[model samples]
Target: MTFLNRQIHFTAAPKRKVLVGFILFLFLSFVIIFVEPFDTDQYHSDHKILVLSGFGILIFFVFVIYSSFENLWYLKFRKVWLVSHEIASTILFFVVAGSVLYLYNGLMINQGSYSITSHLLYLKNIVLLMIPVFAPVMLYLRQQFGERIVPLPINSVLLTGENKNEVLSLEKGNLLFIKAFENYVEIHFLDEQDQVVSRTFRQTLSNVYQQIPFLEKCHRSYLVNMTTAKEIIGNSQSAKISFIHGEKTIPLSKTYYKQIKNRLVQK
Candidate 1:
């Protein structure tokens, strides 16, 4: 269960999906032509190529549809793709594509005279053949083209305000602290020249905090980047935070003193 829940790289690239479909079509056609699987050898030589092409086409369409749906589900929910998702989708592809191909064989080639037992047997054979080809190709494509989910580094953060075009992009290491005043918050950070600078954005502290959760909340109105903090001064009852780059000190509320102290100790 734990292994299935592990996140994996995934891709919804249209070109890659189409390439996969094309590869499967070619592979299936080649196998059917050379191996003469099932009732292929019994078909008339004149119509054999056309009939075999239809089987490949069916597989291609099914693969495209399956991949498109998977891509759509990912876009809609924005969920991380996991091992379980990959496994389930693979099983679904085998069942759906295998069943369709079996029915196609029966109707087009066998004159629709296949029994239930024969259908199951055909499906089983199709699945067995597909497993060796499909699984490795998908794994290779995913490794080559799939996108991994990764968090934005602290050095590259874009702070946006409620007003249009109000934004600040800076390294979190240079950020000192944020001070809240009702609907506005002041972001203090060091400039490239090592000077303390402040920017006022028309956004509440809560909203800003949501954007950068790594910032530690020391008081009701302040969110400090602990990376810039030099040390905690004064006692627990009246604690204050001193920064390495600025003369100003942030007040530490009793509500968050212990938690902040523990975090600072860990740092």
Candidate 2:
């Protein structure tokens, strides 16, 4: 249960998911042609390639559709995906894809005479055989093409102080972190010359966060721009956020440690 609850990185891009599906199609086709795991010998030699290619095509479509829907679900909910979600999806894929393959084999290969018992047995065999191949390929592809940075929706943000006139316009990427001092919040960001600079504003940290929701509240008095965060150093009890271009480190409270860690994993 603990392992399943552990947070893991997820690949949500449609293009990358399609790419993975295409690669899996080629791999399945290759396995059918050479490995002959699915009783390819029963079919006529001349039509073997065509018949086996059908299996790969079905797999490709199922993977693309399933993965795309999963991505859509995540996007709709805006929730953090965990290891349990990955495991559940994998199991669901096996059942869904296996049923499709079983139907294809029965109607096309067995002339609608394939029995349910046989389908069950073959499904078991296929699952066992695929666990080794599918797991590694998916893992490798995700690691290679996973989303590494959080994209900014806008170029710049206008942060206003208590007085409407006290406003600071900053590039989304240049902003580093915000620190609260009593009633005033200090904004730290990079300038045009790529130098660290600070500006003081009469605003509450909470108000600043509402204006720039992308900034992560790592501490009660601090909100860090996770996009600029290079890495998090330290453990669950206490952690520090290091920026990509700045020496400044933001204190990560124990309360937000897990949340910050999950965000970094997505990165």
Candidate 3:
């Protein structure tokens, strides 16, 4: 995939993000409780419970926030690093924010930055409302990274004819039907609502099949995205493969029938 200008894909999930955020929030909360910030006033103890409770409340939305950024960055610029940076930056921001809260209550409050009651109220608002501001910052970081230049492949090969070696990449998806760009193929994605997202890769189908052993010659002219294929139908002259990536049917040739059919069916 590195040889071609194919987009790097990571199967990062929102649910995984929720777990990560919940873990971070919980860990921060634990540190705050055990190493409760140094305070001169007894009233400061209640603030710990308030801050932790606030984290718990905000965690549900934390999951939503991180996942939205991942999906958006994946579609917009097709870079995994953007999503990772967004996640890391957001988590680090919260860590700093939590530490600042500790400093405010532990030392600054005694130094008269704000009265004890006012600080407690500020803590409550911070817990509930800070995400709106931080989310944008994280998003901006992702956008900035997206603006960085990654050159697209300069040379391309046609996979079906004399230039068959020129195809740099080809992907098959259940949601995407065959798209012919002169001689290039692009696998498209369709969501539950039937929205399409084109995932273009530069590479010849033959070279990819040779390089990625998991791929097979599903047809004379069609190479099934092995990852997206579910089943195969027909035999020899009229063979076709069924793709799970989308419900599209692809034709097959006699030369590829039994081998490709067996490979797909066994899976």
Tens-place lDDT digits, model 2, residues 1-267: 889866566678888888888888898889887887756766785677888899889988998899888886555434456677777888788888988888897788777776889789767887667878777786677557765433334688878899667888889999999999999999999999999999999999989987888889999999999889988888867789999996989899999999999998999
Task: Count clashing residue pairs in model 2.
Answer: 0
**Residue 214 alpha-carbon offset, candidate 3, angstroms:** 27
True-structure Cα RMSD, model 1: 8.4
Most accurate candidate by TM-score: 1
Assess every candidate by TM-score.
Answer: 0.54, 0.53, 0.32
lDDT of each: 0.83, 0.83, 0.50
- For model 3, the stretches where C-alpha displacement exceeds 4 angstroms are 1-11, 38-51, 82-267
Q: What global local distance difference test value does model 1 have?
A: 0.83
Model 1 TM? 0.54
lDDT of 1 at 128: 68
Backbone N/Cα/C clashes per model: 0, 0, 15
Candidate 2 lDDT (Cα, 0 to 1): 0.83
